[model samples]
Target: MGIVVALWAAILGALAVAKYRKEAEAERTRIRDMRVVYELQLSREIAARRRHEMTVESRIRRELESESQADTAEQVAALRHELASMRGHIEYAISNTADPRRELTAKPHGDVRELVVSDNAVTDADPGRTEQQHDQDVVDAEFETEYQPSAHAKTR
Candidate 1:
């Protein structure tokens, strides 16, 4: 009877140890799974934050670029308007202005018969005309404002 009681006591002790080991292993496995889930959540949060920051930065840059473009367009339009006004003023002045050549040629001022006779004699004396002489002839023709001598000067 003593041997049987000792054997039963030993069996009960072994069973309690086995149950404690199994419960500890199950708790460790649950902790590991919870840690994995927490890590996944942290990584997702960080990625979402980065994506939001990038989107905000891109939006700000686009708005700034659009504003700059608008200012540039306004400046261009103002410059075009100024240019048009200047062109209108220039055209009006040109239309109102008289021809300088016509004004200079319209009035005769001095007796030039003696000068003409002398120029003709010199040109007849020199049959071979130089480029300088031809240029002078052209200038003289363009600016010829000869008037007849007054009766008082002719009498003198």
Candidate 2:
């Protein structure tokens, strides 16, 4: 009877040790899984924050670029308007002004014709009184004078 009771006591002690070891190993596994989940959550949060920052930076850059383009366009338009106004002012100045010398020199004189001789005449009065000489005499007149040569004659 003593031998049987001792064997039963030994078997009960072995079963209790196995149950305690199994429970401890299960607790350790649960702690490891929780740590893994916590790390995954932290990584997700970091990635989300980086994405948001990038989006904000991109939007800011686009806005600044658009504003700069608008400013450039406006300046170009203003310069074009100024150039058009200058052209108009120049045209008006050319149209409205008149030269008094041109008007005074345009009148014809009848007395100068009496001194001119035809090309066929051979007058011995003065060698310089011929038609060619007379034409040369009027060459020194004002450029705007009525006796000025035509455009075709000036080319020759």
Candidate 3:
């Protein structure tokens, strides 16, 4: 009876140890799975943060680009306005007859004979003068006069 009871005690102790070891292994596996899930969650959070940062940076770049384009447009508009003003000034200078000498020289005369005939014989009869010579003589005459005949000439 003693031998049987000792054998039964040994078997029961072995069974309890096996059951405890099994339960401990299952707990370890559960802890390992939980750790893996936590790591995955942390990685997901990091990825989301990176995506948000990228989005913000892209929006900033787009805004800066738009602002730069707007500035360029304003500069172009200002330049165009300046160009138009300069063109208008050039046109006015060309059209305004402030100097009678400049106007007379700009007129086409075939030669000195034609100029003398057109002037109604105001100067001496010099048939030897050419058109260019007559133009130079007119210019010299205008330079000799100190008093301006017109208001526009005085301003000039």
Candidate 4:
């Protein structure tokens, strides 16, 4: 009887040991899996944060670029307007201005004989003319006061 009891006790102890080891191994596996799940969750959160930051930065940069372009456009428009105004004023002055060449030409020295002699001498010296004469003539014309296109000369 003692031998049979001892055998039974030894078998029970072995079963309990096996059950405890299996339970401990299962707990360890659960803990390891939990750690893996936590790491994955943490990585996902970090990725989401990066994406959100990038989106915000992109939006801000686009807005700033657009604003800069708008400012440049406005400045260009203003410069164009100023240039047009200056051009208009220049045209008005040109139309109203006296010819500088005409003003420089020697006036008749109030002596008819002297004027005739001078004119004759000058014409004789330049009997033959070239492109220089034309250019000088244009210069003279440019210096004359504005006159009616149809008028041959300014009235005395």
lDDT of 3: 0.66
Write the residue-wise lDDT of candidate 2 on 17-106 in tens digits: 999999999999999999999999999999999999999999999999999999999999998777666545544443443421111111
Q: In model 1, which residue pairs have backbone atoms overlapping below 3 Å?
A: none
Candidate 3, number of clashes? 0
Report each candidate's C-alpha RMSD, comma-separated, in the order given. Answer: 18.9, 18.0, 15.3, 13.9
Better of 1 and 4 by TM-score: 4
Each model's lDDT comes to 0.63, 0.63, 0.66, 0.64
Please list all clashing residue pairs in model 2, or write none if there are none: none
lDDT of 3 by residue, 28-81 (tens): 999999999999999999999999999999999999999999999999999877
Which parts of model 3 are misplaced by more than 4 Å?
1-9, 96-156
Question: Cα deviation of 34 in candidate 4 (Å)?
Answer: 1.1
Model 3 — which ten-residue stretch has the worst lDDT?
A: 111-120
Selected candidate, larger lDDT, 3 vs 4 = 3
Summarize candidate 1's per-residue lDDT along 35-76 as a digit string, tens digits. 999999999999999999999999999999999999999999
Per-residue lDDT, model 4, residue 25, is 100
| Prediction 1 TM-score vs. true | 0.48
Clashes of 2: 0
lDDT assessment of candidate 4: 0.64
